[model samples]
Target chain A: MIVTVTPNAALDVTYTVDSLVPDAVHRARDVRRRAGGKGVNVARVLHALGADVRAVVTAGGATGAEFAADLGAAGLPADLVPIDGETRRTTTVLSAVDGSVTLLNEPGPELSAAEWALLAERVRRREPEVLVCSGSLPPGAPPDGYARLLAGRTSVLDTSGAALLPGLAGRPAVVKPNLEELREVTGLDDPIAAAAELRKAGAGAVVVSLGADGLLAVTAAGTWHATPSKVLTGNSTGAGDAVVAALALGLCRREPWPEILRRAVALSGAAVLGPLAGDVDLAHYHRELAAVRVRPEGES
Target chain B: MIVTVTPNAALDVTYTVDSLVPDAVHRARDVRRRAGGKGVNVARVLHALGADVRAVVTAGGATGAEFAADLGAAGLPADLVPIDGETRRTTTVLSAVDGSVTLLNEPGPELSAAEWALLAERVRRREPEVLVCSGSLPPGAPPDGYARLLAGRTSVLDTSGAALLPGLAGRPAVVKPNLEELREVTGLDDPIAAAAELRKAGAGAVVVSLGADGLLAVTAAGTWHATPSKVLTGNSTGAGDAVVAALALGLCRREPWPEILRRAVALSGAAVLGPLAGDVDLAHYHRELAAVRVRPEGES
Candidate 1:
């Protein structure tokens, strides 16, 4: 079973408006709420692909209750650690006229030392074949939170900034960071150089997601770049999580690095075709998988 | 004793950000939540002024619980009618850069016919000396909901559009509409003619709020206009609610038309000087009260 840990879970609220005019009042035409976070999205993708997965999340207050209810309604299994502070919410306003999206993210609640320990204990109790740690560390949480959780476990780490560097200490099997995150953490503009830096820092393998450009991986076996034949257009919100899900599955199956990279690229492209994050069109995935081209760094 | 009814109450949330840019992600610097609705604001203002006031509102779901907790924390008296639908939320975004404000309002939960009946029953049981109905009616609620509640009760009515015209059938002691609402409901640009139209429709008196210009009142005693001596520069969000609060108090105390109009204008100006709705700078209110000018309509 794969276990996903979300340190800062959120209740994602989406508001659809006719148009968004700055400094004006808008009446939302529709409102939707769901349980969302990096790890939650990753676990959701894995589950949707028929993988055995469980999510471990910290929750508190009313928003937390709603998040838990949504997760259950979605039939996703999770272990929830109770906290005193309320869980934060992320608001996305979609403008129907211009199709513009505006996001407002609330910095999640601070976790006390005791709360952090409780969360770690919960994840430890749910021993799994693979552990995936994703998302930002909440205020008051130790920066090395993922490092501590990844200790002695086969894990995939996905995060950015301060949380990103400390997590590398965990020596995760795979560390996935988008281009922006890669540059911010490594201070390198070149994706190849940034991935190399993370691998040297302690990552067993560093996977970099290049948005529509596809996935680049620096592994002990070799460096490889994978891309789809044609770019797919859709919402890219959960594309990275899809990549993470594919990588986790590949690790479990002990697939070769090239095969893993190809699957990751195909799955991510499929995710882009879906309206919401953590969802993918299976038909699109299969079609893209055949079109995905994976080659060693020097082969191109 | 005054009873204020909010058919569609909301949990008002304010997010302060460095700046508001369209279609961009924002991390809120600060967040604030409060129980709010027009009637709730009126009740809060009256309570702050040491008046005997109670608010009647419908609430449900997690947001409702928070709203109730806020009201309790404020030490305000209230009657909460439970419903199956969740209370709505209104989000206000404040940009620190240019001090611009953006508002997003969620349509409140739809109340069932039974729920509306229950709300009316609760208000009837209270038998308030002055009944104050404010804000929009929720979906599934009668457009003439205020009319039914105002029947045979000394009251002040404040609403717009369909809700406004039907409410006049109840013959509320006073009907207050701002310039925009007067035009929208009566289809006349002239406030005097529009106010007259409403009075003819069964309203005992029509009081029109003219923003910085103060208030215009047409009553059986006489036609009068009241204005604050000078414009107070500040947030005007709750100024109308302040006017309603003063009107309720004036009715309870049996103040004359001109005296009531003077107090309404002064309180509204003071509310503008405060940061939030339902709050007035007491010092400013006192100072403005003395400077408020009230004169018969025909007099210069």
Candidate 2:
């Protein structure tokens, strides 16, 4: 089974409004809520692909109870490690007037050292074939928390900021960072150079996401570029998680780099067309999978 | 114990942010949450004053569970009636830069006829010294829901719109409406004239809140006006609820018209000095109570 870990989980709530007037009251036309965190999203995508997946999350307080209840109601498998701090909620206000999204993310609850230790123990017991660690670390969690969780397993890491900086030292099988994250990590505007820097820093493979342009994959097998035949646009909130899910599944099946890149690009494209993160339109995914082009960097 | 009923209860969440920019991400520095509604706020204020008080509220789903937990944590007494729909949440975004509060209130969950009957039964069992039915009615609940609950139990009605219009016909011992609500109910811009119209509509007494101007009481005993010594400026979100609480207590003690207006004005003003709704600065309340001035309209 593919195992994913989310250190800072959230209940993501989306409210659709006719218009958003600053400093004025807004009555939402529609409201939707889901269990959210990068790793949780990744696991959700993998599960939707008919893969065996389990998610490990830290939960506490009333919000935590609600988060767990939401996951249970969705029939998602999770291993919850109790903590003392209450989980946070992230609210996204979608203004239909101009198609703008306003995000309000709470700083997640802080974790005690003992709580981190418990989380580490829980991950160890899972015995995952392809382990994936994603999302931001809770306050007070060590910057290298993901690195320690790696422990030389066949793992993928998808995070940014201090966690990503220190985690690069403990090389995972694959590292995925979007364009902005790459700039933050390497202080370079060039994506290729930043990917190379990450590769040199012990990452076995480096995959850099370039938003609408698609993704670049650099590995010992050789560098590859993959893109969908047509651009699909909706809410691209969880497109990156779709890519990570694809990569983890590919690792579990021991797929070739070219095939993996093609699937990742197609799935990520399909995710954008879907309503929420971690969900892909099966029809669009199949169509895009056939049209996705992946080849050596020099060929394209 | 004084009892309060809230047909539409809410989980009130406050987020303190550096500044609010429309359609942009806001990272909150601090967050606070509590149980809230007009009647809930009244009960909270009365409870804080060491008075025997119990709040009866409609609750459902995870958010409802959290609302009850918050009340329990605060050591407030409550009787929660179950419903099928989830309770709503009201968010207040406080911008530190300009001290502005942006309110976002969700239309509360709809109540089935059975749920409303169950709530009414729960309130009846409480057998309170003085009953208070406050706030807006949920969708699907009858506009005269508070009128039906009153049942001539020496109750006070604090609501607006259609709910207030029919509720006044129940002949509540007191009907507390702010200046705006009085105008909306009677279609009269004059506060005194609007209050007089309400009194003529079977209401025993009419109290109109005038915000910074103070409060006006139109009762069978005599017309009176009460004003605080100075205007306390801060968050006035719960000032009116405090006035309702004071009125309920005064009705229970059978206080005279002038003393009741004086205490209600002071307590309402003191509520503005507190950081949150349902809380008043005790020192401010005492000082303002002593300095409060009350006089007959024509005798002055």
* Candidate whose TM-score is highest: 1
Q: Candidates' lDDT values, in order?
A: 0.89, 0.86
| lDDT (tens digit, per residue) of candidate 2 on A112-175 | 9999999999899989998999988889898889989987799899988888978877788899
The model with the greatest lDDT is 1
| Weakest 10 consecutive residues of candidate 1 chain A by summed lDDT | A229-238
Off by over 4 Å in 1: A186-196, A204-236, A256-262, A269-275, A291-300, B178-236, B254-262, B269-276, B291-300
The share of true interface contacts that also appear in candidate 1 amounts to: 0.82
> What is the TM-score (0 to 1) of candidate 2?
0.81
Model 2 / residue A102 / CA error / Å: 3.6
Question: Lowest summed lDDT over 10 consecutive residues: which window, candidate 1 chain B?
Answer: B231-240
DockQ of each: 0.70, 0.49
What value does the TM-score of chain B take for model 2? Answer: 0.96
DockQ of 2: 0.49
lDDT of 2 by residue, B1-300 (tens): 799999899998888888877667687889888899888899988987888999999889878988988889989889999899999987777777876666667788899999999998988898888999998899999877878888678989998887987887778999998877788778999877888889888789998888887888999988888888987776677889999999999999999988888889888988888788788887888888888889987766
